[model samples]
Target: MADIISLGIDTGGTYTDAVIFSDARGVIAKAKSLTTRHDLSEGIAGAADAALAAAQIDSREIRLVSLSTTLATNALVEGQGQRVALVMIGFGEDDLARDGLGEAARAGPVIFLPGGHDVHGRETPLEMERLQVALPQLAQEVSAFAVAGYFAVRNPAHEQRVRDLILRDAGLPVTCSHELSSRLGGPRRALTTLLNARLVGMIGRLVGACEAYLSSRNIAAPLMVVRGDGALISASEARLRPIETILSGPAASLAGAQFLTGLDNAVVSDIGGTTTDVAILENGRPKLDPDGAMVGGHRTMVEAVAMRTFGLGGDSEVRVDLAGLIARIELGPRRVLPLSLIGHRFSDIVIPALEKQVGSVHAQRNEGLFAIRTGLPDSMAAGLSAQEASLYARITDQPQPLTQLLTTAPQKSALDRLAARGLAHISGITPSDALHVLGRQGQWNAAAARLGLDLAARQKGGNGKPIAADAEDLANRIVQRLTRQSSHAILEACLTDDGETGIDPAKSRAIARALDRQPGVVRFSLALDRPLIGLGASAPVYYPAIAEELAAPAVIPDHADVANAIGAVAGQIRETVTVFVTSPEEGIFLLNGSGETLRFVSETEALEAARARAIEHARALAARNGLAEPHIELMEDADAAEIEGKRKLVEARVRAVASGRPRVAN
Candidate 1:
């Protein structure tokens, strides 16, 4: 058999990576380009073209193409998804108070309907007059709709009706709670569907852009997308159910780590410009979160890899905390546009502004920072407060120094509100600038970086002393702080996997002393049981120290920077179907999920029927999604209780999984 070729692409917060891979030769060529937030296709095409040229291979020879991305995860973490209208059946506004639903619904509006099902799949009289009247106007406000009904999993009649109504009337995308998860918690499921609706248009744009690029290049191949579970799905599935791809980039990186290291168990860490993702691999597979994946403190019912996403990255906003007698450095829980990047892009504007700030004898409170209008449309800026609107009207494509931008007392709060809404960006001294100052990274303007760092260093701490002696000193401190935070993130992830939760490695006294490594009678140390495999372009510069701090061997393999792209092409397709059987009374068995409910007289007969149906459902789904010749496996879990010398059936769950290696396009 001859080797088959595949092209893989991964879009992240900072860079878009592309790779050309062979089943027999492994990675042949890889490249990266800056991610253009406004138009992602530009970045994807640039990296793909570079990789294809490097490999010297004809595009037609590529039999497969796969993609993974961090846009969804980043949007959820940064609170930047599109507006969505939520329809809750048999749920009132009070339901929004549970599971942080009200806060999650901050991006859009909610509607309540008097329709739903009971625990046993009994229906309530549905009311559609309100929704019918609001559909026309809502279409102008929101890009998508989410439908959730009480006990929808038991009987999704009301949810399906609402979905059909939205699609037929508004013609916009719709997400239903029951389709996402069959779990019993109505509020949590609604939260998941609401998030899915918010992300639909964003992910849809990404996938459509990639497809358009492929068509333009005459590269006709099977298009696949990496799911959050590190499995492959057709791009069509990604378009309809993008929430499943929340952690797509991180999951692909985990698979890439396994492929590069060939390790059975290890701690994997990937650092990008916007965030750092850490996960643990057990027996060569990243563990799946059983309770669902949580991002940005919002627990969503999205089944994804068990990983910790920290907002500490290269472009993280670097701030000096002056709380105590000694000043401390703090990295970001929010990302910002790097000063060096903006300086390089608009050197005429940003560089001159930075120079003016550094040379002025007058010290400004917002020194070394600038505000630039984010490229979002004007419609998203609607309903801004009077002050926010005033400040926003002044910000333009040209970077405005923060010192002048926030002249009034109320303008400061207005800028914060604007930034929170993703209407403007604060460009300041970030770790990327620090790296440029230290001469480790030179892709951007170094002079601007030096000036920015010098301005930040001159600031007085709580002790009324300068934070650092010079730019070089401040740069080193930032890098060291990143290293310490990275180590703590990795340790925190590992500890969480070991059933230990809520232990802050960064603040723990013993752990801090251990990482600090200062001599003392009560000395402490930490060591990992497995090696640390690092991925990302910055891994080479950052992970060595992180691994050393944890006393673990660092595996910085070849092509580490493009690992996510490599993993996108290196994975297989997986489809799963779950069937549930329950007994509301003796001598009666009911089966539901994946299809209409059925009744059986005997428990044994119901279990047999459920297992067969599950396998059939999985096989049918895989084939529909372009998986060729899938092999299916079945697992059954049954529950029962003993009472009065007889066993009573409670519930039984049967799951079938189908998987197979990806096949070449015909």
Candidate 2:
């Protein structure tokens, strides 16, 4: 019999990884490539081709293809995505304030229309005139539209109507609240839908790129995407609801950590280019977050691993704080291209620019910064302000020093706006550069890293002195600061997992003293109960120190760097369907689920219908996910109260879950 090989691909912020795996032999080969943001397909193809070549296997031997990515997570963390307009039905301005929707909108246009549905899925006269007038102009201003109606979970009629209109008129990707989640909170659901809408174009491109590449290779295999919950779903499903993939990469890492280390109880921390994700594995499986996946401070209703994502990573922008007695270095919540990387790619431009800046008489504000076009098509530049457009036009494929690119303060702001919109990339001093300067990493130009650090070292501190004596000293300081921040991030995740909400790791004196190993009359000591399993290409370099600080044993598996890719192929196909039965009054039960609402006169009839529908939906979804005979599990939660010696049925939720191994191609 021929070996049944599976291809797993993971696209992270900095690198794209690919691994070839077989059930009998484990990982046969793995390869990595720098992620090409201009066109992700370049990175995907590079990694895939390298892996296939390394394995010396025919592409036709691959039976399954699974993918995972951190693009959605990184986009949220960095506040970068396609601009989208939100259409709210039957929601007032006050509703926007309820779920951080206004803040999440982030200067995006929002239109409130007078239409909605009641608790029982009854229409409240949807107003089409406002949407008709606003959509055309909004389409020019945004890449997609989100339509969320009040109580859309109960009745999606209004939201569906608006979605159809947007699709017909704007011909843009549309996300309706009901399509994403079955939750009841209108504002929160709207927020999820809006975020999903923002990600549709981005995620669609990613999946489309992978599919196109696969088709070109003639590697006929079923494609699956890892979900935020560490399960496999059809690529088509993921393209429509990308919000569910917010933690897809992290979740895959969690699965890979377990599969590689075989540790039942451990704290799994995966560091990537853009984020450090931490989660606890218990009973040989990752725990699910009941409150939903929270990324970049927004709690989404996407079911995912109980992972805490931090913005500290190798490519994190390094900033200095000179406001105190001693200057302190801080790593990022934003990722910047490492000077080493940009220097390697554009050495002529980068080295000369850095050398000039370091030799200057005075320290320049933008000495070590450069901006380059991200290589996305100009169509994404829609709705750019005049200043933003002008600055963007000046940026080209070649790297331009930010000092030369921005002549004035307004132009600097405009450049920033362009970067935020993903039209441009800013390269600066980062932990990766620090690694290069320290000689720990040698993949890029170390001279450029030294030059960038020299510029950073010249900055005045709070004590009115240079922060460091030399470039190496400053690079060490930056690396040490990253280590400290990473420790704090791990500690914070541990505290949150232990349900110690009152003690903030950043401010907790006890934790600080413990981490600092400060000796006093009252000595404080803390340690994690479980060992730490570190996964990432850079994990071996950074996690040992972090584990020591936490007083936990560190475990870095052999293939830790390619863990996400391994997990992508090792996951199982799983699908879930939920049905809700609500009683508006006695003797009338309304069932809601699977994007439809049905009324039944009797409670038994309503429950039976809901159960049957949920099972059917789950089975269908499982089949779509490439599962044949999935094991099905049914769970029901019914809320009832006893009043005046009578049993009252308030509501009931029925859920069906189907899961199995993905089918292999013949």
Overlapping backbone residue pairs in candidate 2 total: 0
Clashing pairs in model 1?
Answer: none
Residue-wise C-alpha lDDT for candidate 2, range 518-589, written one tens digit per residue = 999999998899999998999988999888998999999999999999999999988888888988888899
- Look at candidate 2 and give me any clashing residue pairs: none
lDDT of 2: 0.90
Show model 1 residue runs off by greater than 4 Å.
Answer: 92-94, 133-137, 377-394, 407-414, 417-423
How much lDDT does each candidate structure score? 0.88, 0.90
Query: Which number leads on TM-score?
Result: 2
TM-score (C-alpha) between model 2 and the true structure = 0.98
Q: What TM-score, computed on C-alpha atoms, does each candidate reach?
A: 0.95, 0.98
Model 1 lDDT on a 0 to 1 scale: 0.88
- Relative to the true structure, candidate 1 reaches a TM of 0.95
For residues 1-666, could you state the per-residue lDDT of candidate 1 as single tens digits?
878999999999889999999989999999999887667788899999999999999999999999999888887777767778999999988889999888988768788999987765667989988999999888878778999999888788889999999999999889999888878888899999998988887788789879988998889998899988889988888888899888899999999999998998999999988889999989978999998888877888888899889888999899899777778998986788888898998999988888888889977888888898867767667456677778899999778898888887778778877876667888888899999999999998998899999999888888989899999999999999999989888988899999888798978999988888978987899899999998999899999999999999999988889999999998889998888898988899988787777889998899999999899989887886787689999998889999899999888899999999766776
